[model samples]
Target: GESVGLHLPTLSVQEGDNSIINCAYSNSASDYFIWYKQESGKGPQFIIDIRSNMDKRQGQRVTVLLNKTVKHLSLQIAATQPGDSAVYFCAETPGGGGNKLTFGTGTQLKVEL
Candidate 1:
C-alpha cells in the first residue's frame, strides 16, 4: 500500500537540551518498532528499535520506549544538537513479517540555538 503524504508536525527544542518525540501506533498486533531520522534530501536513517517484549531500548545518546498497553512509542535524544535536527518517523511491523513496515506521519525536529 502507498503511504499518503501529509503535513508533518513540528517539534522545537533547544540545543544541548533533551528532546522527546512521541508516536501513537494503530496496530496492537505489531511486534517490532523502529525510529528513523530523515534529513533533507536523504532517506530515513535508522536511529533505534524496540521489540514489543521490551519496554525500552537504548542507543548512543538515544532511547526508544514502547508501551504496548496504549500502543504508544517514544524516542528520547539526550543533549540534542543542531546535527540532530531532522524529521523523525516511527515504523512498526508485525512479527515474522519480513521487511514490511508501516510508517507513521513524521515530525520535524528543529534544534533552536
Candidate 2:
C-alpha cells in the first residue's frame, strides 16, 4: 500500500523568507511528482514538478526536489508572500504511469507580515 504524507501540518514563515514544505511517499516506484497550491476557494493550482530521473526542478518562484533514495519530495518557495498563503499539496504518480496521483494531506502555509 502506497501513501503520501506531510511532515508538518502547518508552516509559518515571515514575508520575504523562504518556505520549505516536506512530503514523504511510501511508493519508491513513483517517478513523477507535482506540487500544487490551493487558495481559499480555488482548485489546486500546479506550482512545480519533478521526475525521478532528476533530482531537482525549478519554476518561477518555486522549486521541487526529489530524493528517490529516501522516497522524499519537497517544495520550496522563495520570497514568501501573503499571496502565497494557502494549503500546499504534493502528489505523485506511481511507476510514472500517469494513471493516478496520490496526494498528501497538505500543509498550510502561512506568510506572516
Candidate 3:
C-alpha cells in the first residue's frame, strides 16, 4: 500500500466567501500544471489546468494562475460554498517527453456557514 496523503495544509472559508489556494513547485523545467480537488472518501478530481506558456486560465467559478518565473500557482474559487469543502492540491509535469508529475502537499478546505 502507498500513502497518498499523510500531510496537508488547511484553508477555512465562509460559505459565500471566495477562497484562494496557493502552491509552489520546484521544477524549473516543468511545463504543465493541474489543480485537483478531493472530497471525503473520493479520488482527486480535476479542477483546472494551465500550461507554462500561459499566465492564467479560467473555468466555471474557478481560475488557475501560473507564474513560471516564481514557480507559483494559485487556484481561486468564486463564491465558494459548502459543497466546495475538500482537499486540494496541484500537480506539475516535467518538460518535453517527460511523463512524471509531482504533486504538492494537499490542502484541506473547510467551509463554514
Candidate 4:
C-alpha cells in the first residue's frame, strides 16, 4: 500500500461484513504491538494487542496477528458495522525503547451500508 503523506490509509467494507486492516513496522526489536480505533476528532481507543512471542491473539469480535519475521501486523474485525467506521492505528513498543510507543500511519475503516 502507498502512504499518501499525512493521509491515513483506508479500508472500505460493507456493513455486516468482515474487515481486515494491515500495517508494517520498521522495528524488528518491537516486543509489543497494539491496535487502536479512533473515531473522528477523538483519541485512539485500544482494540487489541499482541506480543512478539505470540503470532496471534483474539478479542471480542476482533483479532490481532503479528508476523515477527516480516515485521507486519494485522487487525481483523468480524461483522463490521457502521459504528466501526473509524481510523485505526497500530502502535509498537520496542524492546528497550522505554515507554515510547511508535505508531504507524493509521488505516481508516469505512463501513458502507
Candidate 5:
C-alpha cells in the first residue's frame, strides 16, 4: 500500500517559527491534491490544493509543493503558532473516475509557547 501514515502521534514546535508536514501517497495515477488542517476535535478544513497539472500552489501562510517526478508531496506552514497546532492530513484524487479523495498519513502538530 502506498498510503501515507504518520510515524509520530504529535509534534511540538515553538510559536513564530515554521512547520513542515510530510505525507506518502499510494496511487501512482493520482492527479489532484489537497491539504487539510484539523483542530483539536474538529473536521479537517481545506487549507490548500493543487492539481497534477501544476508543480506548486500557494495560499495565505501556506504553500504546497508537488514533485510528481518523485511521487511525493509536502506542506509548508509559515509562522507557527499555538492556534496553528493541529493534525494535518494530505489527500489525493486518483485519476480515472469520479473525484474521490484518498487520505494519507496524518501528522499531529503542536505549537509550544
Candidate 6:
C-alpha cells in the first residue's frame, strides 16, 4: 500500500539546480531494488540500484540510500538540468521472484528555462 503517484504533471525548475523525486514502495519482502528515469513519455532508463543486504549504493552522479529498518529509500541527484527533467521511480523485486520487479510511487520532474 505504499504506492504513490505525482499530484502534478509538471515540476518546473531552473537550468541548474538539485532535484529530488519521491517514491513509496510496497511489499516489505522485496529484496532487490532499482531506480529508473523516464524522459517525457518514454520508457524508464536504469539509474541506480541496491539490494536489501546493503544500506547504500553510489553511481556516477547519483546515490541511493536505503533504510531497511523503516522500509524507506531515497535518491540523491547531484545537479539539475533540462535533460534531467523526468519521472523517477524506485522499484523492488521480492525475494521469491527471478528478476521480476514491482514498481513503486512515481514523481514527475519538470525543468523550466
Kindly list the per-residue Cα lDDT of model 2 for residues 37-100, writing each as its tens digit. Answer: 9999999998888888999999888988888888889999999999999999999988835578
Candidate 1 residues 54-90, lDDT tens each? 9999999999988889778889999999999999998
Residue-by-residue lDDT tens digits, candidate 3, 33-89: 899999999999999999899999999999999987867888999999999999998
Candidate 6 has its poorest 10 consecutive residues by lDDT at: 2-11
The numbered model that scores best in TM-score is 2
Clashes of each: 0, 0, 0, 0, 3, 0
* Local distance difference test scores for all models: 0.87, 0.93, 0.85, 0.84, 0.83, 0.75
C-alpha positional error of residue 30 in candidate 6 after TM-score superposition, expressed in Å: 1.1
What TM value does model 1 have?
0.90
Pairs in clash, predicted candidate 6: none
Better of 1 and 3 by lDDT: 1
Across 1-113, the per-residue lDDT of candidate 6 in tens digits comes to 64433333445667667665555555688788888998876999999999989988988778888877767777777677777888888788888769867775576777777
* Per-model TM against the reference: 0.90, 0.96, 0.90, 0.90, 0.90, 0.81
What's the TM for model 6? 0.81
- Number of the candidate with higher lDDT, 5 or 6: 5
Instruction: Give the best candidate by lDDT.
Output: 2
Off by over 4 Å in 1: 1-8
Clashing pairs in 1: none
RMSD of each: 2.9, 1.0, 3.9, 3.6, 1.6, 2.5
Model 5 C-alpha lDDT per residue in residues 6-107, reported as the tens digit of each score: 445677788998888876676789888899998876999999999988988999989999888777788888998788888999899888889778886688
Residues 1-113 of candidate 4 have per-residue lDDT tens digits of: 22212133888899999998888887778898889899999999999999899999999999888888867788899999999999998888878758878787788899999
Q: How much is 21 displaced in model 1, in angstroms?
A: 0.4
Which stretch of 10 consecutive residues in model 3 shows the poorest summed lDDT? 1-10
